[model samples]
Target chain A: MLPLPVLEKAQTELVNYADSGMSVMELSHRSGLFTDIITGAEQLLRDLMNIPDNYKVLFVQGGASQQFAMVPLNLLSNSKKADYVNTGSWSKKAIKEAKKYGEVRVIASSEDKNFSYIPEVTSSMIDPEADYVHITTNNTIEGTAFQNIPDTGGVPLVADMSSNILSEEIDVSKFGLIYAGAQKNIGPAGLTVVIIREDLIGHAPESCPTMLDYKTHSESGSLYNTPPTYGIYMAKLVFEWLKELGGLKEMEKINRKKAELLYGFLGQSAMFQSPVQEDSRSIMNIPFVSPSAELDAAFVKEAKEAGLETLKGHRSVGGMRASIYNAMPVEGVEALVEFMKHFEEKHAQ
Target chain B: MLPLPVLEKAQTELVNYADSGMSVMELSHRSGLFTDIITGAEQLLRDLMNIPDNYKVLFVQGGASQQFAMVPLNLLSNSKKADYVNTGSWSKKAIKEAKKYGEVRVIASSEDKNFSYIPEVTSSMIDPEADYVHITTNNTIEGTAFQNIPDTGGVPLVADMSSNILSEEIDVSKFGLIYAGAQKNIGPAGLTVVIIREDLIGHAPESCPTMLDYKTHSESGSLYNTPPTYGIYMAKLVFEWLKELGGLKEMEKINRKKAELLYGFLGQSAMFQSPVQEDSRSIMNIPFVSPSAELDAAFVKEAKEAGLETLKGHRSVGGMRASIYNAMPVEGVEALVEFMKHFEEKHAQ
Candidate 1:
């Protein structure tokens, strides 16, 4: 979900952007107006995240799912071997895609516990000769996240931070590359944001598809071939909203409060419980289960009727999941908790 | 440019789509509302284009540039070779990308004439064993278009129709696949519309990225991953606008009238001349030139001051280009022609 103000601002400028007499979607990608949008977007993002000068920010399409393939296609040039942490479904998909290009070793995994927690990673677990180490910083389906960034010695660390990027402050120097789909904390669904160190830009093999090469995008400044113009405009508005809300540090405090409000209720409730471990819980997606499948179904149905939409869990996991991303107000969590309390009282036996 | 009516409708629904209390960008892809959106969009397109049952419409991402590699990666399984016709810049890029995956033969080319016209493609020029024959049906940079769809003798014709897909009526059965970037005649830049015959699906090798494979998207109904939900919704609005305005046949007539207004002026004007041959000219993009570069610069600047934007020609082929897409009204073309006449009179030799 986007910040309400961002959506409203976009609505105001939807038809005639910046008095250009054309919708953002209609502007030519090479036009000066669009160039300013993309350039301002990148600058705003860098300011919000405190990105380093050594990192190149690329706005591309195909989401994080495409990045699953691209991360390997562009980075497996050294040893052609990588270590991956299998935290949940997204990690497994990334690992599978990476295996197509090189040897992928699962250095650590939480699958033995139904992906309820993030597996610990240390420098010792990583292959020194490996091209890079991959991890999913937050698993949207499994409701787990790495509580701490792992150290990989000198190896480049690649992360898929699709669900939880910009939720809190982080050191830009912690990883060699970071990619996130814009659907979550960024803006919309079509655009993917990639931040990669300059050294990692040109490693793709010569046979790599030009579109899949990081160097191609980096060289062209992400304008290689019409890089999702409208989505970038939306993202710029979102970044403006973030800056107005006092950047990630302030956003993180509010997010933590929202997560605590819901999790505090779940901890005390008899009818509902969080499926994830305490320390590994994701601030973005919080999955919970009731006493029975029927109860779960009733909870999801009633939640929708109460104006809380998309409360259903992924089919792979049985119960209900609450995806309270950065855009979810604290009152939204309070409302869900209040609804749960009333339901618990009514369903008491 | 998108139709003004469509942009207005999108602005009205930008924040609370269908009273769902969420922007279309915020809606879950799996939600019933979004399902209706994607389904309605595909149906409307099918109705407007008269697409056959055997053709599957897949809304994927990464634009036509990604399709440059995907076409060969998926279709080169049989003969490890494909035939391409060089029309202009886009054709050259597509050929370069395809050559990375297989042997790409340029059987017909208008490059000898500076890509000012479409070359004739006969069945004899095609390698019968070629997996498919590729062509850029509309060249945006050079302002050329194939007046006739070349028959490939049952060898499956593929087209990159990015600049002119929805502007006219065409027989879908003649092409094995048709891919267009949505920014031109469709809704936005992020979404790519791929109309492929069923027989051409499932041909990608196992090593191909899941996101790049046609069968992956076709089988999942383009829901294998989160789509560009907002773009799809906008396209649905565009389709609705087209249907309300009588479909492609009516659109084609209006488009022809707009092209005539501008081209007829170019034909009669002594100061300005169209670079393209009359029969091979595109109704979508029209490139014209003045007697000198100084005059061209003056005309573009004067046109912009008169509220005509993006009329400057592409850098590779300089002068002036007025891209009158499906959304350009007859009045807009008339205004452009009127401005041209005034400029020509003031600069009379």
Candidate 2:
């Protein structure tokens, strides 16, 4: 759980957002209070990310899934084709959504390895005629993350950094667009944080809905439509929390420690096995399999009884996953590890 | 303010969503728990609206402003032209956004009358080649509302009912599409409620962004992108509340009484005047101007002192306005009327 003070402060305000004499749910997006929240959140985001003058950061709704289509809509104007690296479910979804709009070239993929690792893709492999190169920086479902950023030379590079955003520092100037859903490391699910190069705006096809036009949204300050108000408000709080915790560098240290402790325990455990390749482990999601599906079911049931919940893996994959997002304290992972050890000992007999 | 029970219940859950052991804000949209919320909300909405089997209701983000563009993108494909009735700010926005996609004809407009009344347009006035007829059922800022639905013959009729949705009963079969922002009579500011006819689906202009395509969102059950989980949850609660209130029929009766009481005071007051034409006065929003802008400011200041807030009008139209949504009880409006009476007498002396 998050700290009591932080949680309670947010809870109290959720019932009544900022002095509006209304719940955040009841406030109007066209109202001055909401516009302030939207603008303030955007400004604070720029400050926290140190986004340079040329990058347009949009506070869009519909998560990174929407960007799966939007990135191609805006970037694939001058060029008919784009290159994509399929890292996991999210990257695959990006590819699927992009195919509707343009010709997407698969530059690299880890599908042969069940997406347990990020494929190594070099800049030379990227087609020069391709409009942009798309990549999913972190694969939440498969528990794999890119340890290194891909080089796209002068080409526009788009990334879905949903799970691992703000958990580590990155050179924002390197990519053309970096989009993240705000549930894992940022704040919430509804808000999609998009940082796009200035030149990437205004290139949407005429058939693109006005709301999906990045240039229109950038010009209107993301208030072109009613954005998720409370989500943005909470994101602002999370940004403040990130800043107070010494930003991404400090977050990276803690995330690394948490991942190492959990992975170290899994490595030492005789009954438990991690599916992902050793070097490609994720810092956000940690998925592991037991000796059998029956054992996995029993393990999850016992873990839930022990207050370790939602450890079930995606339906496509049968295993257990522990998503230790930014909110999941190091102690939470320690508790999970301790629970796993006791469960393993009992099952070993 | 909403009743204490409603506020407290939401507050309790705002800190932690169901079963996830984390705030709804922290849950991933792809997670099962959040998906349940989205589907549950959609189901509740369908139940409350008695939505027919042939209609698809989408819980989209970005509110009705997004729909201003989407409606044209989807429906405008059938014809090179569309007819629009301009009543106020929202209708004006719809007309403006539609202009980007196709030729828009103003069948009738209240703008010449200062948008103080709803224009009376006949089906014969609608162009035979027009794709659809668009109208704003209620104007939030200008406080004008359509007392009757416009007839569009076979050419589809689309309505932007953002402020007045679920506030009254209407034949669902009458509209090709009805879209609403959730802040007023639905749930929150971020989530948009769109009920589109089945036959109207799959008409995207080829280059439309998937995020904004009604057909894509409908087919995917609004999960084409990550939805606003907590907002949808709140909307579910609101939908249940509407059901408990005996649906929109009962809501309309109570709403009528509330609006009459407030308007009664405005009509009798020597110090104030109604902004919109009285015949087309909105049951939801009542915008009235004092004898002077100074008097309007003073009225709002004194009204806030009496715990009657948000009575200040929009910046574009300088006056005092009161928005009496479904959540605002008739007693609240009565209290406002009493305060207005007291203020008028005090200022008259």
Candidate 3:
């Protein structure tokens, strides 16, 4: 979900952006007006994230799912082997895609426990000769997140941070590459933000599709064939909103408060419980299970009627999941907890 | 430019789409609301285009540039060779990308004439063993378009119709796959629409990235992952606006009138002239030039001051371009023509 202010700003500017008498969607990608918008967006993002000078921030399309293949295609030039941590469904998909390009070793995995936690990773687990180490920093479906960034010795680390990118502060130097879909903690879908170190920018094999090469985007500053113009504009507004709200550090406090309120209720409630482990819980997506499937269905239905939509869990994991991203106000969590309490009282036997 | 009505409707619904208390950007990809939006969009397009039942409409990302590679990757399974017509800059890029995947044979090209006209393509020019024959139906940069669809015998035809997909009526059955980036006559920059024959699907080799394979999107109905939700919604609105205006036939008439008004002025004006040959001129993008580069710059500046934006020609071609797409009303074209006449009079040599 986007910050409300960002959505409203987009609404106001949808038809005539900045008196140009054209929607952001209608502006030519090479026009000076759009140039300002894109450059301004990059500056805002760099300021918000405190991105390092060595990192090239690229705004491209196809989401993190596309990055699953791109990360391997562009980075697997050295050993053609990568170490991957299989935390959940997304990580498995990433690993499967990576296997197409090179040898993908599952250095660590939480699959044995239904992917309920982030697998521990150490320098010893990684292959020193590997091209890079891959991990999903947050699993939206499994409701698990890496509590700490793993050290991969001198090996470059690549992360799919789609679900929890801007929810917290992080050191930009921690990873060699970071990619995230703009749907969560950024803006809308269709735009993918890739923050890659300069050294990792041009390693793709010649056969790599020009659209998939980081060097193509880095050289063009992400203007390589109309880089999701409206999405970037929306992201710029989102970054502005985050900055106005005192940036990620302050946003993280509000997010943690919201997660704690919901998880605190779940910990005490007799009818509902979080499916994820305590230490591995994701502040972005919190999946919970009731006592029975019927109860879960009824709770999801009643919650929708109570104005809380999309509370249903993924089909693979039964029960409900609450994705309280950065945009979810603390009151939203409070409302969900209140509904849960009332339902527990009504269903008591 | 998008239809003004469509942009207005999007602005009105940007924050609370259909009273769902969430922006279309915030909707879950798996939600019923988004499913309706996407399905409704496809149906509207089918109804408007009269697309055959055998053709699947896939709303994918990465634009036409991405499809340059995907076309060969997915279709080159049979002969590992394809035919291409180099009409302009875009076609050259397409050929270059396709060369990475297979043997790309350029059977026809207008490059000998500086891509100022579309070259004729006959069935005899096509290699029957080719997996697919590629063409750019309308060249945006060079102001050229095929007046007639080429007969490629049994070889499948793939088109990059990014600049002119919705501007006029066409026979969808003639092409094996038609892909267009949405920024032109559709809605925005992020979403790409691919209409492919069922026989052409699932041909990508296993090494192809899951996101790049047509089978993945075709099988999942373009919901394999989070799509550009808001862009799809905007495109749906555009389709509805087109349907309201009597579909493609009416849109074609209005577009023709706009193009005629601009081109007619250029024909009569002594100072300005269209570079494209008349028979191969595009109704979508019409590039024109004044007597000198100084006059061209002056005209572009004056046009901008007169509230005409993005009239400057592409860098590869100097002077001016007046793109009169489906969304450009006749009044806009009339205004451009009026400004052109005034500039010509003032700068008479």
Docking level for model 3: high
Please give the ranking of all candidate structures by TM-score, highest first, separated by commas.
1, 3, 2
For model 1, what is the alpha-carbon lDDT of residue A232? 96
lDDT tens digits, residue span B9-111, model 1: 9999999989988999998899899999999999999999999999999999999999999999999989898999999999999999999999999999988
Candidate 2 — which pairs collide?
A: none
Against the true structure, what is each candidate's TM-score? 0.99, 0.92, 0.99
Give the CAPRI rating of model 1: high
Ranking by lDDT: 1, 3, 2
What range of 10 consecutive residues in model 3 chain B has the weakest lDDT sum? Answer: B340-349
RMSD of each: 0.9, 2.8, 1.1
lDDT string for model 3 (A157-252, tens) is: 999999999899988799999999999889889999999999998889989999999999999989889889999998999988999999999999
Worst 10 residues of 1 chain B by lDDT: B260-269
DockQ of prediction 2: 0.52
Write out the backbone clash pairs for model 3: none
lDDT of 2 by residue, B1-349 (tens): 2444566677888676675567765565666787777778778777777789899888888778788888888887866699999887888889988998999998898888778888788988989899899989899989988888877889889999898888888888889999998767776566888999999989887666677789878888787766777677778778777778888789899999999998888777788789788679899899999878788889999998988878989888889889998889988998988898888889895
Per-residue CA lDDT of model 1 for A1-349, tens digit only, reads 9999999999999998898888889888888999999999999999999999999999998989899999999999889999999999999999988999999999999999999998889899899999999999999999999989999989999999999999988887999999999999999889999999999989888778888999999999998999889999999999999899999999999999999999999999999999899999998899999999999999989888889888889999989999999899999899999999999999989
Model 3 chain A weakest 10-residue run by lDDT: A19-28
Error of 1 at B242 (Å): 1.1
